[model samples]
Structure formats: structure tokens, C-alpha cells
Target: MTSPSGAPGPGGPDPRRPSLAWLLLPGLGLLVLAAISVSLGAGDFSFSGLLAGTASESWTLLVASRVPRTLALLLAGMSLAVAGLIMQMLVRNRYVEPSTAGTTESATLGILCLMLLAPDTPVIGKMLAATAFAMAGTLLFLGILRRVPLRSPFLVPLIGLVLGGVVHAVTTFFAYRHDMLQSLYAWTTGDFSGVLRGRYELLWIGFGLACAAYLAADRYTVAGMGQQFTTNLGLNHRRLTLMGLLIVSAIASVVVVTAGNIPFLGLIVPNAVSLVLGDNMRRSVPWVALLGGSFVLACDVLGRLVHPPYEIPIGTVVGIVGSALFLLLILRRKGANA
Candidate 1:
């Protein structure tokens, strides 16, 4: 996608010298690692004999466990990244993300509700319920944004973060009361270890939502510039607002339902791209897509390598690492403003 004439636009490091070389190198490295990750396993740890449909104990392990896990990691990362980017843009705040806006927590609540209300319901039903709840959360956040005029830049994300905490607390309360805390714990911690064929199909919902996000790229860009700016450009502000909210909700729901709540992914990736490439949602969208995918994949690889026989959940790593980067960005922006 082409970028506007402001700054360097969102192509890459530079507009004239858009060296995707840097991004490409890491991306390619991750791809190689992911392929190896797909082929390697706890039982056998071999990739040589899995070239064809030839069967080995290792090949079976590779196909059944590693491949699906890798795919889930890729999709979850990309979806959450894009979701975060869009949320920041719509709110015109750098720190915003699905987790912050109560979207992810809302989806978790939706899942819990489904488990309680219809224990035997189909996966699709749960997905739909989660999607609806996520959208409701996003809309509620937007309502707050519209109602409270945030003079300080930090207030926006701070409010959303507080809202998320509230939702999370409520969810925790319910889970504890119902004696479903164990299930909630497993759901909240973003791990890709158990991803297999039938189970992993849910992640495709995230991919589809990401696709829908791309299609609404133009509207989101307009909406990000503020309602007045959008209306001036002959765009329907309400429609765009609703559209953006729906996009954010859909992405959040899919991510929560598929891989549990991955914090700061949406907040970090978009802000990273905006700093480097500028906040042209058109261009930043794809960069957010690649960077998000690459970042998550890299983290997943790190998780694998850090613990040889065991694994670290991606959500914990993201929270620990992403929070640091986010703070750095916040401080930098504050310094610049000062």
C-alpha cells in the first residue's frame, strides 16, 4: 500500500530508501526458525526424515504438534498486532490495544459465559458470542473516549487499562466463585503448546478478521484523523467509528478465543511502526502485519530455546518484554512533548 506525502510515510525505514532488507532479514530468519520449529520436537528433535509423506515417529510428531503450533503462533501474532495498531489509530493514542481496551477481557468473559450458559455449545457459537462481547467492550471504550475529553495524552490508555483491569477482576471473581479458575488460568496464559489439527482451526477466525481489517483500511485511516477531520473529507464519521470498533472487536475476539489474551501486542506493534514509518494506517497496516507476525514468532522461538524440554508461554514473555518497550516509547514521547 502507498503512503501519504508526510514524513517518510509507512513503507519502511525510509521512503526513498525503503530498505525492507532489515525487516526481510529478520522475517526470513524467523521463517527458517519456524520451519525448524515445526520439524523439531521433544520426542525426536529431527527434521531430516520429514521431507516427503514418509512416515517416522518424528514426522508424526512434527505434523501433529509442531506444524499446527507454528501456524497458531503466526496467526495469533499477526492478528493481535493489527488489532493493536487499529485501536491506537482510532483512539489517537499510542498505548492503546485490545488488552487495554477491555476487548480481550470481554472476550474471556464471553467464553466463561458460554461455558456456564451452554456447556455443550459448538465452537462457532462460542466464537460468535466472544465476538459480540468484544465488540461491546470496544464500543464502550469508544463511548468513554467520546465522553471524556482527555487533555493529557496518557489518560486515554490509562483509562482503557483501568477498564481492562476491572473487567479482568470481574472475570477472575467469577472464575473463582464457579471453581473454574483452573480453566480460566489455562485460557488466559497464551501458550501454543497444545495446538493440534482440530483444536487449531479456531485461529483461522483471527486470520479472517485480519483480512476484514485490511479491507476497511481506508475508513480506519480517516477515522484516526478525528471525527471532524473525517467529516470534512466527506466521510461518515459514525459509520467509520462503528466500522473501526467492529474491526477491533472482531480481531480481539478471535485472538482471545484462539490463543488466550496476549497483552501489549496491539499496543506495541502499531506504535513501533508509527515511529519508524509514520501513522499512515494504509502503510502501517501491512508493516504492523509483518512486524507483529515476526515479533510473536521470534518470541515463540525464544520461549522454546530458553527452556529446552519445557516451554514458556508467549503471553508472559510479551507482557514482560512489551511493557518495557512501551514504557520507553511513552517516555520518549513525553520528552519530545516537553
Candidate 2:
């Protein structure tokens, strides 16, 4: 038998040591990117001056805008990735992710509703509404999964795509009718350009949710096993599943609200981490979170640097890069199954 963390059950490698890299490469990469994001912006600044902590308007821009943006990117990226990994594990499928599962779309709809209903609602109130509705959507999907027999692990992803499409259509309908299509566009095409000291506080929700995820890591792994098996081990599978869903919803909503929708982040980062680090949730969690944070920060940096006066949105870079990787995975799976 294998443990949920992808370890050999009884004779597995020592759980005390990380099964993968000597040093967490992904985390190291994230740190490097964070530094770069903090140092570079739309201003003319010397790299040496930044290192020396020189004081200037450019330095202030770097400090105020770029630094907070980098932090938000890291927090949102890590939370979403971890949430996606947990969703896949709980459902026993590799391709299940928050965006595909209709959770993000639902949250977006919630945001749109808030905008329409109470245009002056506080950001926290909007976030709470989004999270609540997003959690409901996740629970609905889980219920649907209970009724449907999964033909293959891959089939579940197809279902999610269809579900997301349906929700997107509904969201679009409301958005277009309310003459808020452009507003919704702004939400879908994520940009870190708006990140500043006061506005970026929403991202802290992701950080707090990540902490909750870490605390529940062991329980989620236990619940990943079949319900009966978990029951035999004296674990409450239902409670764990609900708890995982709550965490997922909170993280997903916060990411969507803060950074717009970043697809495949939840899927690709975790899959890559699992391939290298194995499935041990605890061991994989840190590296996975780091990889996600690093990947998004790098993409955000690319978006900023690639376009000088005008910046590309972070979601665009992620979509382009992540889609390519996702297609490769699909092709590889086809080859193996063929």
C-alpha cells in the first residue's frame, strides 16, 4: 500500500527527510524572482542603487508598488496551487482544478453581483460574498461527483471544463446585460499593475488560507484515501472533505478577487511538484507552494519587462505559458494511452 503523500506505506523512505531535492529549488527560485520584482518597475532606477537602498522616487515606486505586488503575486499563486493540488487529491483525479471546476467562475459571478447590487460594498464584504458562493459551487460539484461514476480520471477534467463553460456563460449573460462587460473583462484579465499598499491587502486572505491548508494537510491526505478505508483508520472523511472544500473556496475566491482568474496554476504547479517530489502532502506542500509563487512572480516580471510603457497582464502570461504546458501533458497522456 502507498500512503497519500506518495510514500511507501510501511517501508517507505524516512518521512523525516524530504524525498526530493536537497534544498527547495522552487523556494529559492521564488526568492530570486521576488527580489527582481521588487527592484524593477516602470521607473528609471539603477539596480546597484536598489541593492544599496538608495532613496529616490524610483526607489519609492519600487518599494510601494512593486514590492507589494510581488508579495500579492506570491501569496495568490501559492494558495491557488495548493488548493488545486488538494482538490485533485480529494477527488482522486490529476486534472481537477479550481478554475475548471467552476469555482472561479462562480466567484466571479458573485463579484459581479456585488458590483451590481451594492456598488459601494467594501472589498472585504465582496470577498466574503465571493468566498461563500464559491464554496457553495464547490459543494455542488462534489455532490454532482457523488452521483456520477467517473469513467476515467481524465473524464473528470472534461466534466469540469463543461461545468466551467456553463458558469462562464451565465456570468457573461449577467455581465453583458448589466453593461458591465468591460468591468468583468478587467476581472478576467488579471493584472498586478493595480497592486499598491492599501489595495493589495486582499491577498492576505490567501496567506491566511495557506496557513489553514498546512494545518489540515495531514487530514486531507488521510481523506484522499477511499472513504471506507479512511473510516477504518478512524478518520472522518466527510468532515475532512468539507474542511478541504472550505479552504479551497476561501483561497480560490481570494485569488480571483485579488488577481483575477489564473488558470492551470492549480493544476500544473502541483503536477510538476508531485512528479519530482512524490505525493507526500507535507513534503510536497512547501515545494509546490514555492514553485507556484516563483512561477507567477516570474510571469508577472515578464509581463512588466516584456512591455515597457504598457504592461501585459499577469493572467495573459500565465495562460499562454500554462496552456502550452497543459497541451504537452495532454499529448503525453494520449501517447501513453495509445
Candidate 3:
């Protein structure tokens, strides 16, 4: 029932399942992009100068800023993509992700609340608050879905978007009242320009959560089959659902607190990967993480180069690209069903 590559195969081979040779290209691409990410920035960094023992400052800059920013990009991208996959499986909808499902908005709201209530809170405290709020918001979204009589796949993400919009409006209103709208914008928009050594280390926590998701991949795959089916298989559907929410919320909070929201990184990557690899989470996790990191790195590199010594936000770049891809996916699905 399964191929040597770990993909399901009843007849002979699943063409959608990629072989090791096919993976090499993207794996190499990720490495190249990471090298470029470390080498390219606002600051002048010349490898030739470093090799000649003349660019001490360039070396310092590489160590202090470039590496950390690149790491943050990879971590944020991987975490969000995996989180999105988990969400889609748990909700049984391809379109759902943290940004749409009120998770990111709730995390942003939590950060805003922290700034107001305890300005002196540490980074860990902010992460905790955001995670808690994100969990509650995701739960609310699920509760709403349960109450709805019709559960069209298209309707699910739309409901999530509406819920996210409401939470975002509340966050915006509070931020405006406190005269902290600018700060709020900085926290909500994805930008790597400000990332430094100490600031981005929290993203490692997200990386850990992503790994945990991999560990629970089988449970999630069964859960995706629906509650009654999962129950019949001797798994606790509600418990698995809660665990998935916890992982998703925690990853979203960490990314928001560290690199800000990279919208649609989660929504698009998992969907694209699922198209090729099917819903076997264990088989798909590495591909999802690699593609996610590569996409964000490409966006970030373009953001740096689009202007002269200035930068565009990664969020803007990803939003433009992601929206187009999202529309294409919807159209493609409609055609298939038609």
C-alpha cells in the first residue's frame, strides 16, 4: 500500500510523489538562497575583502546581522507553513491558515494589550500572551464552524477571514486610542531589516513546535479524515484537535513577536505541497518546510533589491504574490469540481 518513498501506492507508482532526485533541486536552491541572503543586505559585504583580510567590519556585519536575519526568515517560514498544514488537516479545509483564522490578529491584539497593561513585560511574556490569545481566537473560529449548518470548503476560509477582520479591527482601534498605531504596524508587518542577534532567537521555539508537528503527523492525517472516522480509529479527535491548535497558536505568536506576520506563507505553501505530495504529513513536512523557507527567502531578497539602499516589507511582497496564487488555486479547484 506504500511505496519505498513512503507515498501511498496501490497500482504501481504515484507520479505526484517526488523521488530523491527531484528534491535535490529545491534543496540546493534553498542553500544558494541562504548564502545569498547572508551575503546581500544594506551594508556592504564583500567576501573578496574578507578573504583578503581587509574587511573586518564586513565580517562583523555578517556575524551580527545577516546570519540572524536569514535564520529568522527560515524559522518563520518553516513554522508558519507547518502550522498552516496542521490547520488545514484539523479543519478539513485547504484554505485555512493562521492569518485567516483569527490567530495572527489575536496574537497582535495580545501584544497590543501587553504594551498597554505591562510595558515592561519581557519577550517571553509577550510570546505567552500572544499564544494564549491566538488559541482562544482559533477555538472561537472552530466553534463558529461547528454551529454553521453548511460547511462548504470555500465558506470555511471566508468565515475565518471575517473573524480575523473583526479581531484586527478591535486591535487597530485600541492601538489608535493609545497612540501606538505606528508601533502596532511595525509588529504586524513582516520585515527582516530590524532583525539582530538577540531579537530573533525566539523563533527557535517555533522551529521546535514545527518539529513537534512532524512527530504527530500520523494522528493529524487520521484526524483529517473527520471526527467520527478518527474516533473509530481509536484516537481522541478533540484532543488531537486541541494539540494541533496549541502548536499552531504558539508558532503564530512566536513569528508575530519576532518577525511579524508573513501573511499567506502558511496558506499557500501547504496547499501547493499537498497538490504534489498528497496529505501524508510525514512525507510532506520536509517539502513544505523547504518550499516555505525558499519562498520567504526569495521574497526577502527581492524586498532588499527592489530599491536602492531602501527596502520593501516582505509582507507586501508575499501578500501580492500570495493573493494571486490563492485566486489561481480557487479557480483550479472550481474547474476540477466542474
Best by lDDT: 3
lDDT of 2 by residue, 233-263 (tens): 9998988888888888888888777768888
Lowest lDDT sum, 10 consecutive residues, model 2, at 1-10
**Compared to the true structure, candidate 3 yields what TM-score?**
0.95
RMSD of each: 3.7, 3.1, 3.8
Which candidate wins on TM-score? Answer: 3
The window of 10 residues in a row where model 1 has the poorest summed lDDT is: 1-10
Candidates in order have lDDT scores of: 0.77, 0.79, 0.88
Candidates 2 and 3 compared: the better one by TM-score is 3
What shift in Å separates residue 20 of candidate 2 from its native position after superposition? 8.6
Which regions of candidate 3 fall more than 4 Å away from where they truly are?
1-16
Clashes per candidate (backbone, < 3 Å): 1, 2, 0
Per-residue lDDT of candidate 3, residues 1-338 (tens digit): 22222222224334466788888988999999999888887688987998999989998998899999999999999999999999988887788899989999999999999999999999999999999999999999999988986435678888899999999999999999999999889878988889998999999999999999999899898888778888999999999999999999999999999978889889899888877887788888988999999999999998888895888999999999999999998887777656
Off by over 4 Å in 2: 1-22, 50-54, 334-338
Cα lDDT of model 2 overall? 0.79
* Residue 273 in candidate 3, Cα distance off native in Å: 0.8
